[model samples]
Target: MNVEAPWRGNNLARQIVVLSALSFMIIAAVIGAGAFGNTAVEDQQDGALSTNGSYLAPAGPAFSIWSVIYLGLIAYAIWQALPRQRTNRRQRALGWLIALTMTLNGLWLVTARFGTLFLTVVVIVLLLAALGWTFRVAVRTREPRGGVVDSILIDGVTGLHLGWVTLATVANTAAWLTTIAPASWEKAADAIGIGVLVVVGLIGLAIAWQSSWRLTPALALAWGLSWLAVERFGGEPRSTGIGVMAIIVAAFVLLPPAVIRILRLLRPSVD
Candidate 1:
């Protein structure tokens, strides 16, 4: 059965208005977060972890991906707010979810910066799960327009956010484990962190291979692998060898499908 086109019906204007308001709120929140303070909260067990310092550190620099993700989200919000596009149910739902996830992202940063490491991890995990679900839903929707632009935008943003958070969660968990657990537990934590990366990489590959949502995963995989290389060779030695191996395995597993996708894009249409 054909689904009714929500964008062509009632409430389109209202949806646009709501989306615009949400977009403004998100921008304000981001700005507020930046202006709050630059102080580093001290970890009782391990001196201080400065937000700027930690963020600039090798492992910490990875979080900067969020800046790009947030930019994409803002672009998406603006797209959804366009009066011409507001009636699409898929777009509307995606806009709301993006807004929700962005708020959570900001909160996680605050929590983590303030030394609430465990809570920060929890929020990041939830945000990752929520964004993954959002991407899945967007991928299954019938396009409002006769193109894949909306789906690609929504799913791409979701994939990037989810993929990075998946990695971040492992890093956060590792930090916590090292802090609270015995010295012997450090090895076990490293093992578990590498395992999580492998599992998450496979899950990402499955999503990219099986769905129409290919580009985002391709980009995410590239980003993930690049960081893996940096973390391995650029000074941070947290399971460097194993992490690099996992990145190579993931790249190999994803290469064929990515190549086919590229060829499909380059080939001319027969119609």
Candidate 2:
């Protein structure tokens, strides 16, 4: 199978996609940072995006990961647009999908700011799907073509994006549910939150195994889960049960890849 068949002779197309991705990244950063009358995500929709917006919502500081993600994305955009990278097969295979992810991210923020929670959820799910597709392609491409720097800017950033958005989808859906669910359901929030956390844990473990114990996604997942534990333990909608479950889920998601890395360090010839 010719790995380059799909992207053969697509240099112009690749360049276009890379430029569009960079443009979309800039737009998303602007919208996300509250530029041009765009309110913060938490401040929009009557605070439905806040930390207390849902039982599954992480703590306030958990969102700081956006800074890292956005920066990584910008770096990826610039890196992929370089003259030498313009004809790279790996970039050709990935550029269009990455552009789609960037576009979807900007669309999600726009929907969240100006549209309904339901619409925001819809856009986020789409964004997640785009990221998931990107992840699949990265896995299929397997060996990093452009070496360590390429692995970080492309694979690493994509993993972080996918992982964070995976958890965010859960929280976003929970927030949307709050609007439509019966008021009496409030009493069951803790149980529901725990169940969702368990599902998240399972998904994280699956990703870890499937990606050969990739650590970037695990880092993002654990970061988000840790903050959820912090919020539940100390913030409004406090629930010790949920907090403990969150910590447990975080640990489970992190342990597999972490242990793998430790073993590799101890036995350098294992891989």
Candidate 3:
């Protein structure tokens, strides 16, 4: 049993991540079954996020980001449970935050299902805050010499999670705005909406640049924006302007990290 002590020592933290993973799977299953579709009050999330829902809303394909996040989270859970990670510092710092994320995630889906758009926005914002905290911890935590496993399961995955949620909060808020904004604002809402996306997108870029140059977040953001551009350009409620702007924003958010990575590679090495 002495040999197993290290792995078992961090059971509490490990359990939190595992349970969090389980929670994500449960809610994902609910969404998959379409149990939340066409409720008495709200339409399915996809239907609600039409061209009319919010100009900020990406096309349906953009949501596939969840599948990637869910898979990464599952990988994280398993990785944390391994003997090597039980005493891992970064994993420990992130345990409770991961739990908080899973909780808020489920709550977001619940609020969405009940047609509580405002509450859904609140939950997603809280979720994003939790993820942001986790990323802070992730950036500070030290890693062992070989960090491949942790990098794949923790830093990389959580970065993507934080990135997507950052965009999601903005889009969700926009959905709420559609419900509350006056009908007279229709003429100017497009300008206001795209502006919001740009401001938040820049902020997200700054956060990711500080946290990690990993393209995980930018990739997810670009995925959503690329689809939003597609949806706006020619799909529904076509607005060549908004579509062009989204593509620009996506390129903007993605450019910094790509440039930084390239610079690092091109820099001269001290032999």
Candidate 4:
């Protein structure tokens, strides 16, 4: 796609108006759900993971990253809608996808807040899928030479969203199992959650290596490590060892390549 002309015939103002309006609507819906209460289901879970609490679930802090992700997305949307980028096919597509994902994000917040775990999981799953698609398209649109930096930013956001939601989905499924099934099922649910996390971490490592997605893997690994640490020390006592081990394995796989890349950058050309 051709690079869009700047200022001339740009409809950025209209785009911003629409997006701002949509954002307001989403915020209003979230507020109306009484999701702000201290003891709201999500907040209670967060508190449960606090230093004084005994539970070790990772969903609480991981979800807080959504605020940062959303801000990045909103900025990207506005940038794309700017007169200079409006005609850029990749930018336009990314903007639209971000808007859709943001809408779904709001819905997920509302559902999760109301304790509708299943529906919340479904929404987050879709949002992650959308983010993956957008990242791919954005990377494909980059100029061959300098595009890596842009791709890194886009892919970083996408990978982080994917990684976190994959964990959230597992957590949500466990919540459902614990709520609906016999107490005896808790062990099975925890087992399944840890297993899924391991596989997800492996997949994340594979993507990071294959794409040489350096910065993305760092964020993802940090997220995985923090969660594992939380589980290990936060007192849930169930599968904490497994979670920590998974982080270790993921770090061994994901970090070495990034370090190599950095080393190469620092080395002077022999010429």
The top-ranked prediction according to lDDT is 2
lDDT of 2: 0.86
Model 4 residue 87 lDDT? 53
TM per candidate comes to: 0.74, 0.92, 0.86, 0.72
Tens-digit per-residue lDDT, 62-146, candidate 2: 9999889988988888788777887777887788888888888888887887789999899989999898889878867844578
Ranking by TM-score: 2, 3, 1, 4
lDDT of 4 by residue, 116-189 (tens): 65565577678767766665565455533225534544555666665556555545555454445776755564
**What stretches of model 2 exceed 4 Å from their correct place?**
1-9, 142-144
Tens-digit lDDT track of model 3 for 178-266 = 77889888788668867887896787688767775767778788888888888887675567777888888899888888777777788
- Local accuracy of candidate 1 as per-residue lDDT tens digits, 149-212: 6655677777777766665655555565445667675556446655666676677667776665
Residue 133 CA displacement from its true place in model 3, Å? 1.0
Error of 2 at 184 (Å): 0.7
At residue 41, candidate 1 shows an lDDT of: 31
State the displacement of the C-alpha of residue 46, model 3, in Å, after optimal TM-score superposition.
Answer: 10
Model 2: per-residue Cα lDDT at residue 160: 95
Superposition error at 178 for model 2 (Å): 0.8
User: Residue pairs in steric clash, candidate 4?
Assistant: none
